[model samples]
Target chain A: MARINSAAQLEKVRKDIVLKKDPNKPCIAICGGIGCLGGREDLIRAFEKEIKKQKLEGKVDVRVTGCHGFCAQGPNIVIYPEEICYTKVKPEDAQQIISETVVGKTIVDRLVYIDPNTGEKAVHQSEIPFYKKQVRNILGMNPKIDPKSIDDYLAIGGYSSLAKALLEMKPQEVLEEVKKANLRGRGGGGFPAGLKWETARNAPAELKYVICNGHEGEPGAYMDRAIFQGNPHLIIEGLIIGGYAIGAKQGFIYTRHDMPRLRENIDIALEAAREHGFIGNDILGSGFDFDIEVHLDVGIFVSGEASALMRSIEGKAPEPRPKYTRTAVKGIWERPSNLNNVETWANVPQIIGKGADWYLGIGSEGSKGTKMISLSGNIVNSGVVEVPFGTSLKEIVYDIGGGIPNGKKLKAIHFGAAMGGSLPAELIDTPLDFDVMSKLGAAIGAGGLFVMDEDTSMVEMNRFFLEFLADESCGKCVPCREGIRQMLRILTRMSMGKGKEGDIEALEELCEVGSLASLCALGKTTSSPIYSSLRYFRNEYEASIEDKGCTV
Target chain B: MSDILLTIDGKEVRAKEGMTVLNAAQSSGIFIPTLCHHEKLEPYGGCRICTVEVESRGRTNYVASCLYPVEKNLVVRTRSEKIDKIRKVLIELLLAHAPDSPQLLEMAKEYGAKSVRFGKEPSFCVLCGLCVRYCAEVKKKNAIAFVDQGPKREINFIPEIASKECWNCKECFPLCPTSYLQAAYVLTQGLVGFKNS
Candidate 1:
């Protein structure tokens, strides 16, 4: 494997790789994401040994790629360009992957992702509804492009957007275009992208910076981490464009240290970008010199907050500053900074390639793009889903997510991780966008969709989210520090079947104080799950309050 | 920065651009009950405990004050018996899961809570944003966020691995008034309405 040192050399190598497709040989790609890594690495090794045992080394290319996103059906394997998806593969089946599929070029009926509704085994990845609804602007190229391999990314028109940006578009135009597209920050806050960029781009400063909020501290939220694992280059390209638009030369990707594979993949992507002159000083012969450095998040939930994240990057305690001073104006050692989540940055290339109006045509009027939600919790096909914004909850839960697994009735669903609200089965028709979710007392915070079955107790659910918020709160203010303490107690007594009049009123008053006086979003919305759960399922709370026992 | 003025609970409050109705209310000494919220962390909007009746831009309904940004003509009601009742019931259920915390007991007393009206036993640790927010925002370590989602949401170290990264700093423990912080809040106010065992 010769190194493509320059852009010209990289272009030539990519062209050669694109033209040279080995029809005679079969290419096997196994999902190497975190979920699949559970004994799947051993399976990969076994597959390699089996391939070598058959003496089909050169003829067969066995590669371990990133997540295929149907996590509940992992360790997933797909063969291309045929794209035959094999689900729940074991080490013992390594021979079948090599013998039946590799040699016979046939599909393994038993291992395929069977559509639960149709009872039909999906031969190709596209046939599955999980992939059917997803546009895959970012993930579409991931299956073919090896995250660690620079040539693979280049082969699939990887840095072409960066090239186009550097050559054709100015920084301000890029910002305006993204803003025109109404691209909202995917990191919980539904702030307009253009406004954030404009604030930072025009901030009073000689030096400005851009940060990619890869610190996905939300529970069950792994969409950004998966993106970093699958298509690191796309995120890089987005960051590069963001840096150019914000007039920032230096950028940082604040990631959680828990994801070692993601960290490594990103490092490789950065190296690849730098080596090809797509990321470093004077990128692609353009005078604009933008480079990105990876900063490991201390791996705490609250650090996902922009202020805390910025503080961590500065090697200080990750405490959040008052929002009265926006981080965009003074952040990351007091420089005008623009920060966006991994998904937000990843959408830049698409917005640039296709005009904002063209991008807006994909989803609802307000949310004019696709959102990749990491759907988990009691679902049959728990995985990452990228659906148009306007897709209803029913469609997301049943159509794309394959509904609750093991024949359990859907009881509740939680959007936006722990901080986001939970909805009852009645609200299943709610649209799967930011605005619609808010109407139902929820928000699309960092794109995590979790399903709950009948077995789950709403009282227990309320306790669980509060427990999380209590642990995550920074305790900087009295209301959050004290209010959550008091609320937790009342909830504890209620769940224990201990009946006391006015307990509900007490909890409500405390919640009011916390919401009224707390300084940050953490304190404000921490009570969302309990409210939604109580509102929709008051009977559940009543059952526990009256009965004094776990119903399920 | 230019300041915007608004009235919360009839008290004049000054906030900058992008401030939420809740922030203005809190600054004006208005009390709005919330559980999943934390001052030092991000707004999750999951708990819905911070709901308040807000009249702004020609709409009046219970809004999650934490998520609703402030506006010039916004009117917020932070305290109401209806909200108080809902919060008390919600907290009673929360207490059933973590009844030992003195802090919670004391808080329950503030709301005139005597005992939980539902559930059977205390599970320890209420769903507050202290540990998760502190671990992430203050500690810069997402080693422990809410690991599972929905009814399964709980704090767990990332990868569920037993490593020094977790350190059991108990930095998160102190925030859990039921398990670590003061537990009197639960004993007093929260337990007022609870059915005696």
Candidate 2:
């Protein structure tokens, strides 16, 4: 396909791309995500080989897509058109799927998802309880598009939003839609994206920048990787539209250094987009010149912070600068730079294509649009689930997460790991809004929900966070570095049967110093592990002091 | 730059636009304590001992005066009961690493910080980055710099450069808050075996 020079040409190309494709055609989408890759059965090659063995070339399309978000059952495959969801798919099962399901049009009863609680099998992916409550507006496109193919993305009206933004809507109008929609940052902080874009737009700078924060350094968080790797074009499209809106001639995707496949997919998507004129000079004949470059991070957790991320992009050390003036106004070489998470970037096209009111129609009152959460740690389901805002924590833990395994009761649910707080099972009723969760001492931080079972000790959990954070911290501020070290020593002694009388008071003093006097957010909120744990489960710490036993 | 008026410690002070609150406070007589801050270097906000309570737009926030740019009508309190308590804890946290440093001892006395509270881990270096920043910024000799990260972080002299540069010019020696900088330089010189070239 040649470069689409105008909006009419883009529509024509989309029509041609959609004209040749058949929706009824059988497409085998294998979960090739980081979670399920080289899984229990290497099913990608197996399905390909089985398709060839049956000599169904054009009749069947075996596409390796991104994660389907049902990773508890390894090597998931979704047979399309019919949307027949198969869980725990094995290499040998490929032959039967090709022979029975693809050819004979029969349902494979054994591979279907069975609700463990109800003991009932479901044929379609949507019927599973794990997916029933989810509002998968962003990740739902993963199963349909092969990351390497631009046509797959275009078939779903992918760049049509960019077209609408470029052809018809003014930059101000696009900004207005986003501001009215109130789309919050998905990579934590939950600040409105439109406000940042508006700041970058209005700032008195001839040279401005927009960055996609794909350096998902949050532990157990892979939703950014899922949406970005599975569908890079969608995110690139979002970046292009953002650049057009923010009047930034240059854009960047600041992604992680690890995950070579994710990087490879992004490269392919960028090349395909540049070839198709969605990027590069005079995009789609709108005379709006903008291009994007991909930058790799230093692979530290704090490099994901906005200021630290900007400094890292400047080829400097990944130490966070004070953000008294927000990064939107002065960032990335001291220019107005608008940076949003990859997940937040992915939400832009939807808002631009379907108006702000349409986008705001979903989710809660405060937060608009959907959030993708990566479930991990003792949870039964333990996969990526995208649900709208205001979904209660109890619903997410039980319905979507499948609760804790081994018949053990839940002790607490932790969010944002070292920087985020933990809430006991009693407060799991709190909804997944930014203000609501943070008001309860828990945050919807980058949407990583880690569940702890009844046998787990909160005292030991605090020690674990401190131990990990004591090293991962940037070591710039006196309060954070020395404070975490002192707290870790106290928690270790308390866990190792050597608790002192004033250890709790010392920890509290350290927490006060950390919260009040640290330089960055990482320094300030580093005491969250102690804050929420002591708030909800102080008895565990008191018991550890009294019993003088290793809680672990 | 135009003069911007803001109240520091309940007194109206006129500060230049784009000037940090630390400099503005220093222009007046209001004292804000800082350890890693230096006039010749960029404000690092690392030690955070210069934290002051700034109330503006109905929000009270503790910000490092060394880096926070002075805003119009910013109500800055250089010292308060809460600020004293916070400074006491901060000094105590730093004193655990270098209890014998006279500079830290002076501040500890002022803030009522007890060195024995955290029980002395004793690395001696407070990681002020004074020698590092001074060497890099003022002397134009990148001899000593910060290495590693987190609690393992420390300032070390570049033996290759320090051996060539430091014997004639020991400008950073007086800037050390503790004896750790001298000790680290001696150790690095021993490792390099007295480069004469």
Candidate 3:
């Protein structure tokens, strides 16, 4: 339990930890992510009990890991060395799994994912269509590492970026490398992370701060929980590296209050990092000292907005202020605070560990490297997907998501929640680039991609988003609060077949006020769904108005 | 403070650094409508009535004149086709709440805001936060603040404090853009007067 004094010592520790573990040993890693853990909390216990009953103690490891990302096939377990992935596993199957698969080393055909059309069984996790196409640089270790154990992270080269940033690279050099990579922020805006770092680093401040926006409150998005809960040290490592680059001595992780497990995992990871000297004073013999504190969000959608998130950190109400003064220059007690989403922070290690050129080689123009999108809503494979930028919507919808369920025709793809827009099925050929999607009017806000089937009413879908925005709006700004209410009322009446004349024009005017004048991004993009829906599905609005009754 | 030269409605104006566009415009006798702004309180950017088309760093965006700081070479158009349209809608939306506020009606007259376009759902409180901001920023009494959010958002006086402090000082009452604040304060008073006895 000695502190890692130097980079060499850290490397030696990693080697020693790697040497102690057997790579070929039988390990049963379960998907303990929130969505997959539907009464399967005792799956770990069941496996351990079955392993003991078979007297296979010490031979078999029953490790409860974070999300495997194939959540539609819930209660998933992967038996390792063979990388055998089993889905929809029951507690009763634990006995057979230990006796047959662990002892006999045979595949469990009944539990393995079968290609629905072909009926061909996919044995390994990598072989499955969902995992085959995904670039799992961030979440690839989810099935291997135990989140509670820092050694699990270290064994797989976790804190090496922090070590390299501290010992090898200068703070300015590290900042330059991130800038060179053009690592865009994954937290909604896709602002260049390095530019933000340079500002925070150069801003005159005796004290500054860096924050990880773990408040993934964007409706159906759960990628933050997937990777963060899977490997807490990944974000911790990235945050420390960011802290070193940004010249900040302190960091804060502002996450959701509703998810206790996500916060608990982050807490355990921080304590482990502190004990190992990866976070505390003079990390890895480098004179630079930085530490992070975890803070719970106010549990609202706007609380995830950068300004409001900082206000909550300052123990104030999570209402957003205008960003005329960027949070990077003035934030959190008026100190320069650089805040990036958890996914953005998670990508920092890869950029730093590998060269900027190597990181830059992964994705398309303007956007560099992979993006973790939380795929949900009428899709066959409802899970977390990490794909490189420029991956076509068709690829994601069909290859990764396994297409729409129940032979339903694809209606539209809604990216982001409430504050984002919807794309019709015809635009499935579009790339997942920052500029391309925003140009199409559908922003990749927090990477929540909801697939709507033919049965899905575009009007009802848009109404749902507006209702959510109306409910979640902080009501500080008149344009956002009153605008959303008025728009929602018109849409509500339209849905119930009471659409009056000029309702469309009234909604459009309110939308203009929302986008043009509202104080923050939440207000600025409040009309996104409305605008996008009205653009593509104006006929749906007219249909509802023309005595079609409630289309939903 | 040093002077920052900027163009307001095509007129060159010298404003002190750290001064807002609203302050700069008002000093130059330019008319920019605002509802939630107060000289004594902090810039709350809530009303969006003072929103102007500001061109900075080759990008033009709509920002509240009350909150956006004056920068060098900033082009401020207090009145533009888009800015006027946005203000008209913002006024119309606020009118849905406080349809009869003298302050809103005056701006509506200027902007030609049509309130009948939107359905009537009068909660009366425009959520300008003037009364709340006045109580907290000016009085430092923390007597009243906004409670709840979105459509349900309202200015509520803390019964414990308003019962004692408000009887002597009804300072925030005059700051309310609508009579809703007085109605809210009266309701809180009745509740508190009953509780105290």
Candidate 4:
């Protein structure tokens, strides 16, 4: 195992690790994301026992990876090389995963993920309509290995990416490659990765830092937490790589304290990285000293903002400052710092391992790489799914999400958490890329894709968003403070059909003012959901105002 | 830190980096109505009441100042006729939803919310991200969060089937505007105590 330092070395290591058939051995990867932890716990053990019973323990490897993203297909089991995905697997089906797929190299027709609309049994994850068009850059590692086993990741050439980066490419080159990939921050705001790194690199402070925003505050979103839990090391690796690239000696992962499991696993993974010399004051022995510390959240939604989050990390109350410097130039104790979300960091090793050209080849123009989405709410198969950028909302809900449960019709789709906008039933066919969603008045926020059914009330929906905004507005500014108070009142009135003749017009006006007067991203993006709702579902507001009641 | 001068509602004020437009107004003794906006939780930008008119780069744009970062040469309008009208409607809606609560009713009246046009119905937590954000940010114990999607979304106490993830710290209850938290606590406490008794 040679310590790799650069892309040239990575290219060589990749060739050396190109997967080929052992013929005598087979591999199985299971879904270890929290969504599957409970129901699939026993099944995983059963799978282990069945493998042993069949005397294939040494020859066949069974590992668990993080969220496969298609949570609806939980108790997910995928066979290697062939990429055959078995969905809704129960304890009874464990034998089939081991015997049929492991031994005979055959697909289990009944256990395969079935497309609800086409009624087709999806065997290979790629062939499945939900996955076929997906690029899966951020979530690429989920399907290939288990989160619990480093060796499973190793066998699939996981650390090889890091090894190559350390041994072959220079830090500057690695950053440039990432820039060429055109990777944007997938944690809601599409900030460029290279720009942050360059700013940090050139900043005037000596104690530079890199922070991982694992504080997934969006409603109905869990991509960051799932990735952190599923493949803690991958993120750690990315963090270390980011630290090295930006010349930072320290890094921090700001995760909510509520997710004890994620915190615990990340600690364990950090220890593992330290043991491997991947973290803690040195390289594979390259003398590039970089380390990471976990900072549990102190309970402020707005604190996820770079400056506010930095304030909390310093053991201060999480509060916002209006004229704060960029986190890249003056963050984390007023030093030059770079912040990327869990998903952003996860893509580093891959880009460094495989050339930037290879990474750039996937995804639509401007938005490259795969996005892991937690598809939940109202949908029949509420699960996690990782797809390439540009996949449509219809494909995610129908093809991967298995449509709404009980045969309910979809009313609208909400993207980018609570602050994001909702699309009407007519736009269900819309593609779910960054540009497309922004044009539709929605954004791919934090990777939480929640489906809504016909029973959902749009007025209530907008009001719900308002309620979140009002409480989380930090009260540092009048527009956000007073504006949210007023908006919440109006939305509540509208939802209850107490809206006056000018209520809708009033709301539209407030939407404008709130957008203009607010002081941070929280206020700036507040009207996003409201405007989105108004754009698609004006009738709901009209009903609340004109009809003096909710239609639903 | 260097300070930049900006005007909010014709009041020229100086602010530092990391301060929001809302903070500048409040410091200047200008009060704005708010609902879900809490100082402790992360900004959700879910509510639109905190909106204002911002003139920047020779153009005017509407933004929520709570979540928006203030910049140099930015002019902000905290209140306008358009903003007030919307605020009144929002109050009316809150009154209708939680008509039983005197607090909401008074706010509605202040905003000139006349009446709820429809019959009253049962209510829940106002869907403010307080509990959810608190669980994630303050307690660092995100046992409960906003679960489900769309208008029917709720503050789920442990998504994908309930578990003991909730320490029942009662942090979310105090922050809930609609008293849904109080109701849930009472019901849950009663059920548990009854079983034990």
What tens digits encode model 2's per-residue C-alpha lDDT throughout A1-552? 689998888878889988998889999888889655646346788888898899997789988998889888757888988988898888899999999999899998999889999999989888999999999999999999899999989989989999999999999999999999999988888998899899999999899999999998877788999899999999999999999999999999998887788889999999999999888888999999998899998768888888999999999999999999988889999999999999999999999999899998989999998899999998899899999898998989999999999999998989988889898888888888999988888888898888999888788878998887877888988988899888998998887767788888898889988988888888888898798888898877776674555454
Note each model's CA RMSD in angstroms.
Answer: 9.6, 1.9, 1.6, 9.4
lDDT of 2 by residue, B156-194 (tens): 777778777877877777777876455565546644764
Docking band of candidate 2: high
Against the true structure, candidate 3 reaches a TM-score of 0.97
Worst window of 10 by summed lDDT in candidate 4 chain A: A1-10
Q: Who wins the DockQ comparison?
A: 3
Error of 4 at A110 (Å): 4.1
Q: Model 3, residue A76: displacement in angstroms? A: 1.0
The DockQ score of candidate 3 comes to 0.85
How accurate locally, in lDDT, is each candidate? 0.75, 0.88, 0.87, 0.73
- TM-score, candidate 2, is 0.97
Off by over 4 Å in 4: A1-23, A49-60, A79-84, A95-110, A113-122, A160-170, A402-409, A428-430, A468-478, A546-549, B1-197
Q: Mind sharing the TM-score for model 4?
A: 0.72
**Candidate 2 at residue B133, lDDT?**
89
> Which 10-residue window in model 1 chain A sums to the lowest lDDT?
A1-10
Candidate 4 lDDT by residue in tens digits, A232-285: 878888888888888899999998887777777888777766765667655765
